[model samples]
Target: MEFDLKKSLEILDKTPTVLEAMLQGLSDEWIFNNEGDETWSPYDVIGHLIHGEKTDWIPRLEIILAQQGGSKFDPFDRFAQFKNSEGKTLHQLLEEFKILRKHNLEIVRNKKLTNLQYTLKGMHPSLEEVTLAQLLATWVVHDLNHIAQVARVMAKQYKHEVGPWFEYLGILK
Candidate 1:
C-alpha cells in the first residue's frame, strides 16, 4: 500500500506498546535468545530501535525539510546498540522507545506537511539521495522489520522442540 502519513503513524505509535506487551518481564530465554551469532536478541532489537530514534529517522527528515537543496545525512550506526545497550534492561528500553516515538510523532503532526514537502530531498550516506516520503516510509517498515525479527528470533528458541512441524512453521525457517 502507498504511504499515508496517518497509516504510518498508526504503526509507529503502536510499536512500543506492541513490543512491551510481547516482551516485558519475559524470561531471558525469550528476551535474550537468538538464532545464532550476529543475530539480534529481542532485547537487542529494542536497543537498536532506541538508537534509531535518537539518530536516524527524524534527524534526516529535518535536514530535508529545513533545506532547499537538502543537506547530507549522517551515516546511521547499525551496530551502536551492541555498546549502547549495555546495562539497560528491557523495561528501560521500552519506555524510551515510547517517549521518543511519541515526541517524533508530535513533531510530524505539527509540521502539517504538504504533498510538495514530502517530495523534498536529502542526501543519504549510502543511497546518495532520497525523499522525505521514502524516509518516512522506511521509518515505518524498519519498525516492522525489526518486530518480525524479534518474533522470528523468539520462535526459533523452540525450533528444535517443534520437530517435524518446522516446515509448517515458516517463522522458524
Candidate 2:
C-alpha cells in the first residue's frame, strides 16, 4: 500500500498509548523476562525504541530533505540501548519514549511536506537510493515490529507451561 501521512501519523501517535496499555503496571519480572540469551526483554525493547527516536527516524528524514544525494545515512547502533538505559527504570524509559515521540511528531507535522518531498530520494548505506516515503513507512512498521516482538518474547515465557496449547499457538512457535 502507498504511504498516507494522515494514517501514518495516527499510528505513530498511538504507539506509546498502545505500549502503555500493554505493559503498564507489570512487575519487573514480567517486564524483564526473556526466553534466553539471544532475546531481549520488554525493558530492552523500550530502550531500543527510545534509541531510534533519538537517532533514526527524524534525523534520517532531515537528511533526506536537506541533503538528498549528498550523504548516506550513518549506520544505526541497534545495541546502544544496553549502554544508554543503564540504571533506568521501565517507567522512566516509557516516559522518555512518549516525550520524544511527541517532539518528533511535532517536527514532522510542522514541516507539512509536500508529495514531492515524500518522493524525494536519499542515499542509505545499505539500501542505496530510498525515498522519503519508504523511510516514513519504515518508521510505522518498525513500531509494529517491536510491539509484536515484545509480545512474542513475553509469550515465550509460558512456552513450556502451555503444553499442548503451545502447538496451537503459533506465537509461541
Candidate 3:
C-alpha cells in the first residue's frame, strides 16, 4: 500500500495515548518490575521507545529529507540509552515522546512526497540508499511494530487469569 502521510500521523498519535494508559497509577516499584533479567519492565520499555522515536527514527527522517550525505549514523542502542538516562519516572519519558511525536507528525504532514527523490548514503556497517517514499513507509511500519509490542506486553501484564472459569467448566482439573 502507498504510504499516506496523514494516515501515518494519525496512527503515530496513538502511541502516546497507549503509553499514557499503560502508565496510569503505576508506582516506581511496578515500573521497575521485571520477570527476569532479560525482560524489560514497563518503565524500561517506555524509555526505550521514547529514545527510539526521538534519537533514531525522527532524526533519520530529517536526514533523509535534508539529502546531506556523508555523516555516519549509528544504529541506536535503545537499552543502552535508556540505562544511561537519569530520569526517575516514566512520566518524563512519556512526555518527551509525546512532544517529539507531535513535532514529527507535523513535519510528515507538511511534506510533499510527490516529485521528491532523495538518496540516503551510509557505508560504515553496510552501504544503502533509499527514496523518501520508502523511508516514510518504513517509518510507519516501524511505529506499528512498536505499538503492537506495547499492546502485547500490556495485555499480558493486565489480563486477568481465567483458571477459575476453566475449572468450573470442567476444562481443567
TM values, all candidates: 0.97, 0.96, 0.71
The 10-residue segment of model 3 with minimum total lDDT is 116-125
Tens-digit lDDT track for model 2 on 1-173?
68999899999999998888889899877899987987789999999999999999999999999973575788899999999999999889999999999999999999999999999878888889899999999999999999999999888888899988988999998
Stretches of candidate 1 off by over 4 Å are 68-70
Model 3 lDDT tens row, 46-162: 777667766766576666656565544567675764564465557777777788788877766676555444344332224455555566666667767766555555444433466
lDDT for model 1 comes to 0.91
Backbone steric clashes in candidate 2, count: 0
Root-mean-square deviation (CA) per prediction: 1.1, 1.1, 4.9
Clashing pairs counted in every model: 0, 0, 0
Clashing pairs in 2: none
Q: Which portions of model 3 show Cα errors greater than 4 Å?
A: 27-30, 70-72, 118-127, 157-173
| lDDT score at residue 57, model 3, on the 0-100 scale | 65
**Which pairs clash (backbone N, Cα, C closer than 3 Å) in model 3?**
none
